[model samples]
Structure formats: structure tokens, C-alpha cells
Target: MSEKLRVGFIGAGLMGHGMAKNLVERGFPLTVMGNRNRQPIDHLVSLGATEAKTARAVAEASDIVFLCLPNSAVVDKVVLGPDGIAEGAHDGLIVADSTTADPTETKRIGAALAEKGVAMLDTPLTMTPKEAEAGTLNVLVGGLAEVLERARPAIACFGRNIFHVGPLGAAHSLKLINNFMSMSMVALFSEAVVTARKAGVSVDGLHELISAGALNNPLFQKVMDWPLKGDASGLQFAIENALKDVSYYNRVAADAGATAPIGATVQQIYALANAQGEGKTHVPKLMDVLGRLNGL
Candidate 1:
């Protein structure tokens, strides 16, 4: 709180905008790179955050750069490609990523950044974008203790429950696992809903019974939001993203010599939804997707 760090942010998408907004409101000097979307970029600039032409420019003006991009490929390109953050890397600079990404890729990127004296932390996040906008996303930090301590102040501006998991890549590994479980729950609830309807049981009855039983979960309520209340705002994740994370979990498990039968099945389910052209549809709408599948 005493000394505000200069912060640079890339990927001003769903989760990034809120995280970047909090950084500026919390008083860190902010520099931001423009992404495909201009609304969040303009909004951040309107709040007194400086806009940079490229990731390199953002990095040049920052002591710490945070990336909240969608995937590993884009994150890698922004940090390591032409006119990217690597071009502007300096000694003692730090980069933290909140993208749900591959652990192997995260480690490789961190190692590459280390050679340039830029410490990297994989700080994958939990909670929704609503929570992100509220500055309360739970931060699963994966990096050196000393580096995290140095970067804690700025991270504290947006995180609620921040905890160190391990060295670089650990947080990402955990994130993939966490996402897989949550997305699988979405699929499970969707099937249960359709099955309830097909068997002459109302979704309302199913929801009421589950609400009082061990099958109840926050996600169960969210998925039920669609059938019971026609509200998809409860879980805003895209079906495409669900497939991505589930597939990533399977790959991570294979790399570790572990089998993931559940992850494999979940991957195919989301793939089916995506093939049905519901890729961009949010998770709560999975109820509809499965409902149609069951002819209900």
C-alpha cells in the first residue's frame, strides 16, 4: 500500500476487464494493450489507464505485467512473439498469468522469461467474472515465494483468497483440474435435468429434492437456472471453453502417466454440444442442449 507498482495488463476480455479495472481503481499506475474488443480497452483508458499500441509497449512501461488471456497459444504469442512483451522485458520485471492454460507451456514460457530476468507466475483464477469485477477472484498462485511476495501488493488489488500452490505451472495444473470438475458437473446436471423431464419428473421437483440433499451444489443451482427460471446468467462459461479445459485436463493427465476416464467422457460431451453449434452458449444452457438430445 505504501508504494504502488507500475502495472501493465494484456487480454481485456471477460475476466481481464474487471481485473484491470480493479488495479486502476485500487491505485496502481496502469498501462494496457488493446485486444480484439475495444469496449473494455476504451473503458479502461477512460478510467485513466494509459493505452499502449502493443504488448511490447505495455511491458516497457510496466514493472509488472499481468496476462488474463483465453488460451496458451495467444498468451505465448503476446509474451514471446514479434513486438511482444519479450521485446520490452527488463531485469527485475515480473509477469503473472491468470489464463487457464497448459502447465507444460506455462513452464516453458517461465523458463524463457527467466533467461531475460523476468520472473513469471502462473496465477490461474477461480470464481466468475462477476466476482472478478468485485475484486474477489480466488488466486491460485504458482511461483517462487520471494517473487510472489514482491508481486503481492498489486495482486492484492484484485484477489480475495490468494494462496501459493507451488512453483511455476502448479497453479495451471490445478486450474485445469478444477475447471474439468466444474464443467463435468455442468454436464452431469444437464443430463439429470433432461432425464428428469423424460421420466415424467418435473425439473422443479428435481431441483427441490436436490436442494435438500447431498447432490446440491452451487453449480447444480446455476444449471437449474435455465430450466427452472430461464436464466443463464448463473454460469456464464462458454461450452467451447468447457471442451477446451476438459481436453486440456486429459492431456495433462496423460503427460503425468495418469488415466482420466471421466475427463475423456466429459471432453466428448462438450464436443457434442459444440458440434451442435452451441459452442458460444454458456454452461447453464447445457440443460437445453441435453434436453434436445433426449427428445424432451
Candidate 2:
């Protein structure tokens, strides 16, 4: 690694674009892989970041590679598939995954990378693309302490609050738990608002009470207010993605011989929404799905 770490970023989607931009702007030598969407990749290229044709190419050219991909499945394919990161990784290369992923799968990937002398860290992010653009995202990291320090500078390019939660898979586990809490709240709030609306209570009134109470939170506000204004893109997280996180959380609980009845119910709620053709809808649009379910 050079004095300024050579960084490669994969998945230049909504969140990845902003994160990569911050790293490049902060003076890291960045190489980014092209994505299906060229806009972000082109933007980064114009900002002095190099473009690579494949994940392997990116990994070959950088000391540390960052992944802001969509899910664990994609992460798996990108890191282990033929011509993937594992193929090009060198000793001392660090792969920092900022995706909310399955902890078990993350561990497997980490162990595989370890065999190649490539360190893998689960550094899942919180907040949204807006926060990513503002360089104020929260990063929950899981890996060895020394490895966390090695990646901290690049992580800090986009994360205002960085927590080293545990080792190997702990950050991803904590992310699932965090998403379970957040998405469950959205599910409960969705059902409550619909029930209240059917009983002639204004959603605004419900919002006021919750906003003034101990339950007030940024998720509650965005989930409630976004749809009220007929804009579901405020959260920028898909219902399907929320369902995936909750499902992973339930699996994590079950594997640990614990119960997750609430998580199960929340997963079902998002499953129902996804089944009703709202999978691609923003998570905040759960309100709309619940509304349609009750014939509102």
C-alpha cells in the first residue's frame, strides 16, 4: 500500500457512487468497476477515478477494495465467481463490504479470502444515498481490530460514525438486527396507520402523536411523511430488500436457537407487500400497500 491507499470500488450504484466520489475527492487513488448504470461510473471517471471492466481488474489495481452491492448473493458472485475479486486479490489486499448481507455467507467469504491472504471485513452501512452523498453515513464494521484500523480512513470518507462492532461476521449480524428493528417499525406503523385511517383517524394525527412521543425516529418520520406527500423515494430502500434483511435476521435468530416471532411477522408483512407486486417499491410505500390491502 502506498502513502495514500490505492482503493477500488465495485457497485457504483446509488450509494456506491457517492462513497466512491468522497474517497477520490479525499485523495485516495480510486479505480471503480463499471456498472449497468453508466451515469455514476461516468461521473466518477470524470472526477479523475479510473474505470475497470471487471471486479478482478479493480482488485488487481488496488490495495483495498470496497463493495456497496445490493445483497449477499451478488456479493458472493462478485467476490468468488470466475474472474472475481478472489482471482485477482493479492496478499494484504482488504475487501471492505458495505452491503447489508447474510452474516453466515459473509463469514464463508471471509474465510475463503483468508486462504488467499486477502482480508475481508463486513462494514455494512446505515442511512440512505442522501447520507452517502453528504458523507455522513454510519458504518458498522466487523473484523479484526488491526484490519479495522487499516480500512478506517477509506470508511471515514463516507461514514461520519464508524463502529467496530465485533469480528468477522458481527457487523453484518448487527446490521440485520438493526434493519429488523427499523423495518419492523415500518411494518407496525403501516398496519397502525391503515387501521386508524379505516376507523376515521387522520394519518396526520397518528403521526403527530408518534412524533411527540418516545417512539419518534427518523425512520418513522420518513416512512410516514414520504407517502403522505405522494413521494415514496425518500427512503430509497426497496421493500424486497427490507424483506431480505428481515429474513436474514430471522435465520440468524433461528441458527442461534432463539425465537424471532416479531421478526417472522415483519418478514411476512414485507413478503405480502412484495407478493402484491410492490417488491420494487420503496420501503416507505408499504403504507400504500397496506392502504390497498384494506380497500382504502
| Residues 137-167, model 2: lDDT tens digits | 9999999999988888888999999998999
lDDT of 1 by residue, 224-296 (tens): 8888778998888999999989988998999999988999999999999999999999988877888887886
What is residue 286's positional error in candidate 2, in angstroms? 1.0
- Which stretch of 10 consecutive residues in model 2 shows the poorest summed lDDT? 225-234
What global local distance difference test value does model 2 have?
0.91
Evaluate model 2: give its TM-score: 0.97
In model 1, how large is the Cα lDDT of residue 252? 95
Report the lDDT of model 2 for residue 6: 94
Model 1 lDDT on a 0 to 1 scale:
0.91
Clashing pairs in 1: none
In candidate 2, residue 172 scores what lDDT? Answer: 94
